[model samples]
Target chain A: MKNSNENKFLSPGHNACAGCGQLSAAQAVMRGLNENIIIANATGCLEVTTTAYPQSAWGLPWIHSLFENAAAVASGILASLKQKGDKKTKVVVQAGDGGTFDIGLGLISGMWERGENILYICYDTEAYSNTGIQASGSTPYGASTTTTPDGSASIGSTQGKKDMLAIALAHGVKYVAQTTTGFPDDITNKVKKALSVEGPSYIQILCPCIPGWKINNDQAVMMGKSAVQTALYPLLEYSDGQLISSSLKKGFQARPAGEYLKNQGRFKHLKDKDISLIEKLAQANIDKYKI
Target chain B: MKNEKVSLITKPNTTLANKTGAWRTAKPMTDLLTCIGCSLCAKICPEGCIVMGEISESAANGKKLKPKNKKLKPKTDYNYCKGCGLCTHECLVKAIKMIKDY
Candidate 1:
């Protein structure tokens, strides 16, 4: 779709948090999409915040399905469109990490296994922000949430983040990409590329949450940028089972993970050992992704 | 008596009727003197509330600037700005400031 100031699919005026990374990423996603699209949104922050009673932020044809059935709904929409012989119209599934990584995985897998023509976009906010900041499967280690508080006895969530990208790749998806809210253009380009593909595509975005991350609202973009620069969440893309592009460059040394962690209250209670553990995690990502 | 069912669909794009600026606790005030009319604030504004228009002479700080290349200034439609302060933070010259909504 052409990027014009006057042509926006996701017009602002919803109840998204100020400086919300998800909303910004959603805007970028909308920019990448053409007018002939139908979106099946899972029940989450994006769905709830955008579609309050009698108001909606989406300019496109949108539907809010059950939290775990967005992929299924999109698959149905694809089937209907195909039956109608509307080859030009696109089908998209938008969901949060809770819906994508945990609740809706089975249905999403089914959609991919069926080789449906759909684009699934997951906004990874780490935790369930809309539901009082509870921990989700995608929540990173050492981050505190209401369900996984960092007290003297605990260092927040004990488990590491689930590798959803690897799972997507394993699903034989032709197009799979991972980006963060730090890079709006990257998100837009990835969405455009995913939409161009004929079969199932998945793009996961690391959208920083203000309340969930316990960071100031203004720090969402900074935190997103830091998350990438620190090598904790590098931008990556895989096309047809091959690594095609990455955001990391040669001689690109990562900033300390603490630089990304220190600004957030979620990691406030982390001890030096915890910070070192997180640093080790970042290092592992750097080594694995070859950033 | 025949029963009537309520239509599930309402008019599309009716969200424009909802004035969300009332939810803002703080409002952004743009400094026309420092603003270079680069339109970064408008580009970064998630609310799509910032509109670029001709700079007024009173706010021009007596620069005797001719309108070249549509030298514009950002005027926010507070009707939807949520006081995110993103525009303020993203401003290259720090031209935008967040003041009390009152």
Candidate 2:
């Protein structure tokens, strides 16, 4: 029996914006998975775009719940699979940073605490991209968003990005990694590795949003690379509470944070002083990661 | 029972009926001669409309071209492409151009 669809997972013809970094990264994530998996997706950009009424882009057994309940939903799915004594079918959760870091944090922590064999992927756009670019818990400092608009009297996004990796580690997740849309191969490899590990695993991917970041449609890939090169968000991996590998270890000399900040309209209002302040954040990452 | 309806569940990959290509104001065209066939365009395409196709006489006007890096060239499905120009902008050899769609 032959299926008519050619795409193995997230299919084409979905209504996501052109050059969407999140969707592109999703393709990479899908590339790493086989047919033996079920995905519980949160209510966010990925969900709304793919699963419009009477149409779905997903080519797998996917379930969508409320924004804050994807982790909880996955837990239920895991329980069902356990009851059926099914070991081959993997359970996965997909969420935007808004869901993972803010709305769904409690449910995610509970899922992690139970030590379930689930792979949770967070597409970190840094802001609430689907909700008109509002400030999310993952939103970095000095970046303008709808809620954190930069003005003559103020800088954008007063709060720094929440350290999600530390929080995941604190929960004792077996595998944790971070990558960007720029490195699709790395994203796929990390996903494969995470799935191989037992128990809960977390992979955070920095996905640039076109309108949210005030970037040209074609610039998403470039901006994704720049984010990594600047050390604002470096490619990282942690296994069993130990720093295992990083992009810096692969001989990437960190570029200045200003180079990354200058490209986006979100950071256009930042002066040299403001940029240097942001640089301190990058420096802190470099120091903390021992890169 | 034959007329029973499934509730709250849609068929998989039914979004294929939604031709998002109509939203494009521009379209990407690749120069076969200059293309290195890195397949980055196909890899990065959000629409997943770009597929790497083998270069044959039917594609190259009866002249065989030597492979520079890869043998396959990107063939875009305009019915789904939104003309994001990611291919044109990210082409390593500057082979793709964004032409206004008619």
Candidate 3:
């Protein structure tokens, strides 16, 4: 929401460590918005990392609120802006995995059903990364976290990450999509498209966390690209129940999700058969995205 | 309030598909209190955007080089930033955001 002609994000100083894909994913979304846009960021990695107590990395007009209420506050901002004939300013809400899939679900759904023009971007680092690596609804099956510890027969998260895309579609929002940090250009473009659309828009990005996910800072983007290659995460766009463009799959042969997991410490709990299950799950994701 | 932003393009090459690549900007700011000054951003900056500044060379990753100035101030050059954001994204102090002009 920080707006200059060129540097709309106002990212001067931030404390998010390297390999924190949340920063990049968040910046990508902001870069794509109109310079006049205003943003409401939820409490999580993006909030803690960008807006430190005295200073903020934000160059745009941004407000950080309770994790569960970001969408609602953003919705209110949109209404107020429209009421004043400030129709050109775009309103966006940024949330993390914990807020978007768990605590904030009801509010997000309500925003969708209301068909507010807000563009909700979830920078899903896949857990409650700020507090600690705790499993949230967005956490993928077999991934390790504080809650899903690496122990005997305990292959981290047991269920697939909730299908937020499908859920958004069910809400019948004008637009919904999935993206990853490895695909910055695609993510930026989608953000722009969502902004142009007339109704509520939802896009979730797979933001890999360095410390939380137990991956190297250098390996982050490559891991993200690999997730899509392995079908652990696919690139695609959707609207009103119709099929839209699917970002490049590279169809480079679906590597097992285990391959994607191998580089990260989060999935260290996984064993051979458990890894196989992850492979199956990744395949399932690939199959679903093929449409 | 209708939140009014456009959707990100699904295609890869549209003009709207702005690239967020590697960084080459200058002035690698790390949090002194939090940063051990590991020089990770300096090591990762492909363009060598960072340099030794007020702090000793031993204390920082590199020299106190200036960030290439651009349309935006506080010293930012989007021309060189590349958006790789490798420096701040990996900063031990968590200081960096690829904040530059469009």
* Candidate with best lDDT: 2
Better of 2 and 3 by DockQ: 2
lDDT of 3 by residue, A128-180 (tens): 99998888998888888888886766767887889888889999988888888
Per-residue lDDT over A1-291 for candidate 1, one digit per residue giving the tens place of the 0 to 100 score: 122354357776778888888987887787789988999999999998878777777788999869999999998999899899999999999999999999999999999999898999999999999999999999999989999998889999999999999999888999999998777778889999999998989999999888888787777667878999998999999999787887666777889888899889999998888899999998888777763
Of the true interface contacts, the fraction found in model 1 is 0.33
What would the per-residue lDDT of candidate 2 be over residues A45-64, giving only the tens digit for each residue?
99999999889999999999
What C-alpha lDDT values do all the predictions have?
0.85, 0.89, 0.69
Those runs of model 3 whose alpha carbons end farther than 4 Å from true positions after fitting are A1-8, A248-252, B1-102
Clashing pairs in 1: none
- Give DockQ per model, in order: 0.39, 0.51, 0.05
DockQ of model 1 vs. true complex: 0.39
- CAPRI tier of model 2: medium
User: Which runs of model 2 end up more than 4 angstroms from their true locations?
Assistant: A1-6, B1-6
Model 3 error, position A243 (Å): 1.9
TM-score of chain B of 3: 0.38
